[model samples]
Target chain A: MQHMTIRKSLIWLGGLMILAFLLYTLLDVSGTDLTPQDRINTFSTRFLGIFIEAVPFLLLGSLVSGLIEVYVSKDDLLKLLPKNPILATAGGAVMGFAFPVCECGVVPVTRRLFTKGLPMSVGIAFLLAAPVMNPIVFVSTFIAFGWGEIIVLRFVMTIVVAVSVGLIFAYLARPHETLLPVSFAPVRGGNWGIQPLPPQKMTLIGGLYRAGRIASDEFFEMGRFLIIGSLLAAWMQTRISQQSLLDIGSGAFVSVLVMQGLAFLLSLCSTVDSFVALSFLNTFSTGSLVAFLTFGPMVDIKSAMMFAGVFKKKVVVYLIVLPFLMTLLIGIWVNIWMMR
Target chain B: MNITKIPAKDAIKIMILFGMSGYLAYTILSENLGNYINNSRFVWLTWVAVGLFFVLGVVNVLPFLRPKADATVLLIETSSIMPKSWIVMFICALPLLLGVLIPSQPLDVKSLTGTLSTTVSVSNTTVITRDPLKRNILDWLRAFSLEADKTAFDGTQAQFSGFIYRNPEFPDGVFMVGRFVVACCTADADPIGLPVYAPQADDLAEGQWVEVRGTFLAGEFRRAITPILQVEMIEPIEQPKNSYLYP
Candidate 1:
C-alpha cells in the first residue's frame, strides 16, 4: 500500500509539473508578439542575469541546510526552549532580531529546530520574524531611506504582528496531536545483513562523509522544488501584466490580497523585494507596499510547502492565515499613522 | 543490496556541491587576497559556482534513469506510463515560455534617453551639447563649490530639463527642482537642485516643467554655495511615457 502511494504521488507530481509548465508557457507566449530569436535572446539574457543573482543565495541556503541536517543534533535543541508556548514564541521572535537569516535559509534551520524539540509555535515565529526583524534588514533599510521614523515604525509593526500571530496560533494549536508526519529517517552506514538497523552515530573524522550523505539526499528532494519554483516565479514575473496588479494594489482590500499572493509567488529575498516594492510606490499606497515587504518573505508558496512538510496542515493553514491578517492590520496601522 | 550504487549518486552530488561551495569561498577570499597575492587577474569564482550548479542540476536527473518495472506492485496495476522524454521536454521548455516571450512596457529606455538630452545653462553660452572635457573639469570644481556653499556658474555647460520651482528670492531666476530616481519607491526619493536664470523663469511657475541650456557659476543661495547655471534658453517638454523609472 505504501509503495502504491509513493508511485501514485510521483506520477501526480510529474503531471502537475507539466501542467505548471504549460500554464506558464501559455501565459508567456500569449502576451508577447516577439519573434523566436528575440524570445531566445530575451530568455538567455534575462535568465542568465537572474541565475547570477539567485544561484549564490540558493547554493548557500542549501549548504547551510545540509550542514544543519548532518551536524546539528536534535537532543541539544529541546533544552533551550521554554516549556510554555507563549514565552517560546516570544523568545523565537527575539531570536530573529539577532540572527540575520533570510527566509530561504530559515526554512531548513526551522525544520531542524522543530526536530530538535523546539515547540512548533516557536519555530514558526522564528521563521516569520527572522527575515524581517534581523539587524541587517533594519540597518539596510535605514541606510537606504535615511529616516529613523520609517525604520522604527516598520520594525515595531512587524514585531507586533509576528508575536501576536505566533501566540494566537500557539494558543489554538495542539502540538503532539496536530504535528504532521515527517518521513525523515536518518541514513545508516555499514550495511551488511538482511536486518534493517537505525542510523548510527559516525565519527567526527567522518564529518565530510556524513555531510555528503545528508547533502545529497536533501539536494535531490528539495532541489527539484527549488528549480521548479524558481522557473515558475521567473516565468510569472515575465508574463504577467503589471498594469492590473498596480491597479488592484492601489485599493485597500485588493492590495492586501495581491500583495500577499505576489509575496508567496515571487519567492524573492527580503533584501531585494524592497527594491521591487519601491517601483510600486507611486502605484500603490505606502501601506500596501509595506504589506508587500513585511508579509512576503514571512509566508510564501515555497515557505508554505516547507511548513507543510514539517508542521501539521492545520498549523500551516494558521501560519498562512495569520500573516495575511497581521499584514492587513499593519497596512491599516501604517495608513492611520501616516495620515495622522 | 547496492551500497556502492547509493554512494555513487551521493559522491557525484557531493562533488558538485563541494565544488560550488569551494569556488564561492575562493572567490570571496580572492577579492580580499589580492593585496597579498599581487595579481590583478584570476579566474572568477562565481563561474565555478555557476558551473557546479549547472552540473548538479543535470546530476539530479540521473536518478530517474532507472528502468521501470513492467509488472504491477502493491496490488496496483498500470498499463501505460507517460514517456520521460515528454516530461523532460516540458520541464526544459517551461522557463523560456514564462521568462522570455512576454510583453512588458519599455520604461527604462525612454526615461534614460530623456534624461541625457535635457540641458543646463552657463553664462552667455547656449551649452546645447556639453564637451566631455569641460564636464570632467566641472565635476572637480563642483566639489569645492559645494563645500563652500556658494552658487556660481563655471564656464562648463550641461543640458538640464526640469520644473522651475521658484523661491521668494529667485522669483526672477529658476530653482530647477526635480523628483529623484530611487530604486523602488518615493519613500527614498530626494529632490535635486539645478538652479538657473532665464528670461522665461518669470513665466514658469512652481510645477511648470522646462528645459534650460546653461553653464555652472559659483555663487551662494540660502546657506549653501551651489553651482548655478546661466540659462541660454528655456522651454517646456511633455513628460516622458514612464512616470516612474521601473514598475
Candidate 2:
C-alpha cells in the first residue's frame, strides 16, 4: 500500500511538471516580440535542424532493424540463452550488443522474440537494454563525449537499471501474468528450449531482397516518431527561454527530473541522443545528465507506446515505474556524491 | 493498372520520402543545410539518407513491377501495405514542405539568448595562442578570461569577423561584435562577443558582417574590464560559407 501511494504521487508529480512546462512555454512565446511569421520561421528551421541531424541515424537504425528481421533467426537465438532464469535475464541485457535495435526497432523485434518463446524476463531485459547497448550508440557517444566519465556513467547506469528491472519481473511475476494473449500464447510452452515456431530458410539474395523491403517499411514506421519528436523539441526550444530553462536546471534534484522529463518527451533515437545531451553539459548536473542519457533511451514517449502494444496494461505500468524510480535515485545519488 | 494497384497511402509515403530526400540533397548541393546544422558529420550522413530514401522508395515500387505474381504473394504483399490514415501522411510530408516554403537563415544578431557569455569553461580546450590574428571571437574570449592581468592584451594585433549588435549606452565608437558558436545544432547555440572600439562603427548596421584588424587595449565593455579590439582596418564583407563557428 505504501509503495502504491508513493508511485501514484510520483506519477502525479511528473504530470504536473509537464503541464507546468507547457504553461510556462506558452507564456514565454507569447511575450516575445516575434511576429507569428518570425516565430514559425524560427521554429521551422530548428525543427529541420534537429530533424536533419537525426534522420540519417534513423535511416541507419531502420535498415539495420530490417536486415536483422530478415536475416537473424530467433530459433537460433533461443538456443543461445542461458538455462537459469537469472543468468538468462542478465544475458538478455548484454545481448543488446549483438542485436542493436533502438527504442523503435526494439519493440517489433522484442515482440517477434516473444513469439519465438524467449524467456519473459529475458525479453523484458532485452527490450530496455538493447537501445543503448549497441555499437552504433557506443561510437556516437564516444564521438560526442570521448572516452570520458560521461560515457562510463551512461553505460553503467543503463545496465544497472535494465538488469534490476528485469530481475524484479523475474522474481515477482509470471510470464502468463504480464504478457498479453498475443505474446503469452508462445510463452505457454514454458521453458528455455521450447520451439513451437518453424525454422526459416532463405537464400542470400532472397534475404537481401526481403531485407530491403522490410527496411523501407521500418523506415516509414520509425520515421513518424522521429519527425514528430523533433517537431516537439524544436517547438519547445522556440517557446521556452533557454537561459531560464538552464536556470531551473541548476538544482541537482530538479535537473535530474527535468532532464529525465525531456528525455521522455523528446523520444530521440539512442544513436543520436548523446549529441542532444551534449548541449546541456555545461548547465545540468552530472547525475541528471546521465539520467537523461539512460532513462530517455529506455522509456520515452515512443517506446512507452510500443511497450503498451506488447505487454499487458498492468505490466506496462511496472515497466515504466521501475526504470523511472531506479534511474532517478541513481541520478540523485551521483549528483550528491560526484559533485562534491 | 499496376501503378493504381499500389495502395494510395503507400504511393504517397514513397513520394514523401523521396521528396524529403530531394530536399535534403538540394540543401547540401546549394550549401543551405549549413544554415540549419553543422555539416562536418552530416555532409556524408545526409548523402546516406539520400541513398536510403531513394532505395526505400524504389523498393516500395518494386512490388508493383511484378503485376502477374502468384495470388498468395499478392495477398502477403497487400497485407503489409495496409492503408494508413491520411493524417500520418501529412505529418511525414511536413519537413519537405517547410524546407521549401521557409527561407533558411542562421540565428543572427537578434537571437542572443543572454548577455554574451563572458566566462565559459569549454570542456574541449584548444590552445588559444596559435596565431593571434587567426583567433575567432570565442578563442580570444577564452584568452581574455585566462589572462591574469587585464592589460596583458595591450599591443596585441587581432583580426576577427562577426555580425553586429550594440548597446545604446555605448560610446559613439563602441559596439559588440558577436558570433553564435554551435556545437551540434542551432538549438544549443550560445552567443559570444568582443567589444570593438571603432570610430567608423556608427556607420555599420546591425547584423552586418565585418572584418576588424587592429590592436587591443584594456577597456570597459558590458561594464567589465575586457580586451577591446581597436580597429585599424574595418572592412565590410559577405557572410562566410559557414556562418557559425564549430568548437
lDDT of 1 by residue, A36-86 (tens): 444434333233333334444445555555555555566656677777878
lDDT of 2 by residue, A71-118 (tens): 556677778888888889989898879877677667756765776667
DockQ of each: 0.06, 0.36
Candidate 1, position B106, lDDT: 21
* Model 1 CA lDDT for position A245: 51
Task: State the TM-score for model 1.
Answer: 0.58
Per-model lDDT: 0.51, 0.75
- For candidate 2, report its TM-score: 0.81
Candidate 2 wrongly placed segments (more than 4 Å) = A1-33, A100-120, A139-148, A169-202, A249-251, A258-285, A299-322, B1-4, B69-78, B81-83, B110-115, B145-151, B167-175, B197-199, B203-205, B218-225
Best by DockQ: 2
> Which candidate's lDDT is highest?
2
